[model samples]
Target: MTEKALTIITQREDLPQLFGKRIENQAAIEEIITKIETESRSITFDIETKEGQATCRSLAAKIASAKSTLDKAGKARKDEYTVTADLIQVDRNLVKQRLQLLQDEVRQPLTELEQREKQRQAQHETKLAALGYLDVQDHDRIGSKFIKERIAFLENTVIDDSWEEYKSQALETKDNALRILRPEFERVKQREYEQAELARLRAEQVQREQQEREERIAQEATAKANADAERQAQQIAQESERKEREAKEREARLIAEKESAELRAKQQVIDAAKRERDAIEAERLEVERLEANRQANKKHRDAIFIQAKDDLMANGIDEETAKQVIKLIHVSKVSNVTIKF
Candidate 1:
């Protein structure tokens, strides 16, 4: 017999009949299909035949092709709703330019302030050295009171230098403190920036991976849905075929039973007719046997009488005496007769 084609649809709620009974629920159909699939897989896995392998490969290829088509369709629909690449690129460029401008504006003023502070620091150091040299020269030339007075004047005149020296020392201390801390602080700042950049990259990578995973899952889901539909359609086709086969088998069985009954009836009729013929033959044989026995007895009796009469005539006896003797002789010999004559 040629095999019928099959198709399965996932959304269908009712399956075709199997053995005259309808399968109404998709869940039941699914369970049966699962079992069939499992059994088919097991059989395929166990078999070593080239044909079996080829059949399995063909089935797999068909499934793969169906999945690919579903995936393409899903992707097409998704593309219709998704954001455009050019818009994203434009937004990214704008943010990058703004950040660069902010960094340049902050760096320029800070550089100029640092350079002027360095010049003032050098000038203040030179003035302090000149005031100290002048103080030393005036110390040996005058009396103590005058020397003290000149010293006071010099000290007074050098107040600005001393102030400048103090200010320079303070500035040097501040600069030195800044010098010691700046590189380390900048290094910390750079590290913070690098850490932020690294974090941003990691976040972006995580997001991309998550998005990819979601897409893969969606594709798998769509393929599974299509496969389920195909399996259901196949199950429905199989059920319909099974029901048709069962109906044919049942009809054939009924026909066979009718033929068997008719044969039995014919055999009984033949046996009865044969019995009647046998009875008639037996009656005919019995009648023939009776007729033959009667004829034989009559012939025997006639021969016995004839023989007695001849014996009487030859012996020269009176008719009555001869007759009596013949009767006796006949009676005695009758018991020993061998032939009818």
Candidate 2:
């Protein structure tokens, strides 16, 4: 088939026409691609090596079988071709389909491998350039050295066995390589997964720490607020106490002043009463002295009037004069004495 027709056939949606089986091994193809990737990294390629040559020979055999089947189908009689084409097509198509499937499956993985190799080569070039040991023209020298080393190793290794033993040994070596490499690859992947989980846990821990710090700060703020409130309350209580004390002092001062004023009023009343008693005593003494003086003066006046009447009677006077003198004496006796003594 032409390359264009082959491409169309591979891209066709009808699976039975292109591939022999109804359900193509798409998942197996993917698994094989992964296995190839693992093997490419660990196993070195040696075109001259027996194992390498054997793989190439098997692929060539499959191609030859497909071509022979196609030739036979085309050369058969028209009636025979019609009946046998379907059976021949199934066998021929299976071989071609497997080859195409492997190519398709390896294409993307091989591209990825090439990219990785380029990056590695670039890094190596950068390092070698820094050390002044790299030459762009001599890039294939390293690949030539690797090929020479593989050839030398194959030549030196002795294989003294029948074809069956050699095949068994080759199979054993392939199995051993897979066993060793598969575990190592899995370990590397597992380590990467573990590192990712560890990073997530660390992030969670940091968030928890930040939350705890915030809670601590809030608690401290609340405690400080409570303390400030308590202080304010204490200040208010103190102010109230001070006001109460001041009021009590003022009340006491008023009581003392009022008591002092009352004492002064009582003292003044006592002094006035004493003064009134002294004035009444002085009036009584004066009245007693005036009564004694009046009694003495009246006694002196009575004695004088009696002495004058006796003297007038003894004298030889006219009857009328004597009588007048006696009359004066009797008048003095009847009238109240006007003594000025």
Candidate 3:
């Protein structure tokens, strides 16, 4: 008996009879691969010849092509087969063992790093709390806000040298706070004393002004009273002077009336004496005139009588007889008339 050979090449319609079992699209894939092998034969070369370097490049390209086909075949095989529960469990256990081995390698070191970080944070907090407490106790020496800001700046330093630098900076801030504020206390106290003295002097000035105002008001009241009294005295003196002048005028008028009456009585007596002297002179002149006329008449009568007597004597009549006739009939009278017989 002779052995028959296996053939991979088949037609698409007879792939199930050639394999003696039912397969999925095997005959179609065989037909496509047979066409590629036949058409790609022109790319082959002899390794020992000059063109043999191209054979290395061709071998690399064939390897890449084979890797891509193997990946596709793996995906297709996974799709065609069903995974059992036991197989999935076995794969999960293998992944868990690898993860546990990696965690164990770093576990102790990670715990130590976490504990160290917690201790560093706690020590930094304790130092900051102590700084705040010192400022609250004596605010003049240490300022809380100043120290806190300095410490915060120090905390953000480089991570490799964080602890030692932060500690050194926090201690330096506390020392500087005490040095700056120690010398400012005396100046503030002296300023307060000067302000108190100025307030006292201003109060004294206001009291003196009030006293002077009261004295000026009193002096003005006294001056007004004196002026009113002087005006009243002047009015009384004027009234007295007017009454004295009127009394002197009345006395002078009475003395002038008495002198006028005495002059009128003396004039009446002198006029009566002049009238008596004129009457006596007129009576004496009348008596002298009457005596002179009587003497002349007597002389004339005597002469006429003597002449008549002489004529009688001469006519021879007796003188004694004629005398007797003259006596009887007054011859002087008869002769002027001639005697009639």
Candidate 4:
């Protein structure tokens, strides 16, 4: 069956069309593509022979020529359509711009109303947030007194008709802010109390340590004083004992000297008595020795005289004359007239 060829339906005032119809050569281009595919299958390329290569190159030239023709035709047709499309786009842009202007003009009052409503809502939200605004930041650093003041201020704030439609919400926000602040206030107060209690405990501990140190020092002082007193007493006792011993030694030495002096005096008297007795004995012995020697001398002289007298009698000498001669010689009266005796 042969289908009818399509045609471009540009500039059609038919049925309020929004876009142009397809190009007129579209069906003919499809038939041409089918015919080219069937013909290309019949043309074989044998690159092993020179004639075959020449034939293949001739076929490639023909195909390239056909391709160039088809490209030019397609580009020309596309250019014609592009010019029409560009003109339509210009008209469309002009219509859209005019419609946009009309639309802005139509919505001006509503836009103003919407803007005013948005501003009113923003103002309402800002006022409501202001009612609940907690200016205290850094809860840990805030003091308990400041927290209390904030709570009091929040509790006393009035939610009146000035809030208008958001009065209830404002009141609720203030109450919620108070509820949050009151607990924080109590927590801060508790922390402060705990810190104060800890400080008090530390102070007590320091005072206790100081007291114990003082007591220990006092005890040490007392013990040292007692020790010093004991040592001093011992020293005094030892000194007293030493002095007493020294005095006793001195007394004993004095007594010994006195006894030695008396003994020496007695010995001197005994020595004097012995010397007198020895002198008397020596004098008596000397006198007795002298008397004995005188007697012996007299006996010897008488014997010698008798012997001489006997010899003289025998020789015609008298005993009385010999005795006279002996007496003269003994008295040292005769010079050369001594007897032999």
Clashing pairs in 2: none
User: Where is model 1 poorest over a 10-residue stretch in terms of lDDT?
Assistant: 1-10
TM-score of each: 0.23, 0.22, 0.24, 0.40
Q: Judge candidate 2 against the unseen true structure and give its global Cα lDDT, from 0 to 1.
A: 0.47
- TM-score of model 3 (CA atoms): 0.24
Question: Against the hidden true structure, what lDDT does model 3 obtain?
Answer: 0.44
Q: Where does candidate 2 stray beyond 4 Å?
A: 1-177, 242-341
Ranking by lDDT: 4, 2, 1, 3
The true-versus-predicted C-alpha distance at residue 240 of model 2, in Å, is 2.6
Stretches off by above 4 angstroms in model 3 are 1-171, 218-341
Which TM-score value belongs to model 4? 0.40
Per-residue lDDT tens digits for candidate 3, residues 285-324, read 5655776667566556555555666778788878677656
All models: lDDT?
A: 0.46, 0.47, 0.44, 0.57
lDDT of 4: 0.57
Task: List the pairs of residues colliding in candidate 3.
Answer: none
In model 4, residue pairs whose N, Cα or C atoms come closer than 3 Å (at least 3 residues apart or on different chains), thus clashing, are: 312-317
Residues 71-177 of candidate 2: C-alpha lDDT, one tens digit per residue: 34333422344554555455545444654554444344444555776877666445333322222232332333433343344444443443233445544543443
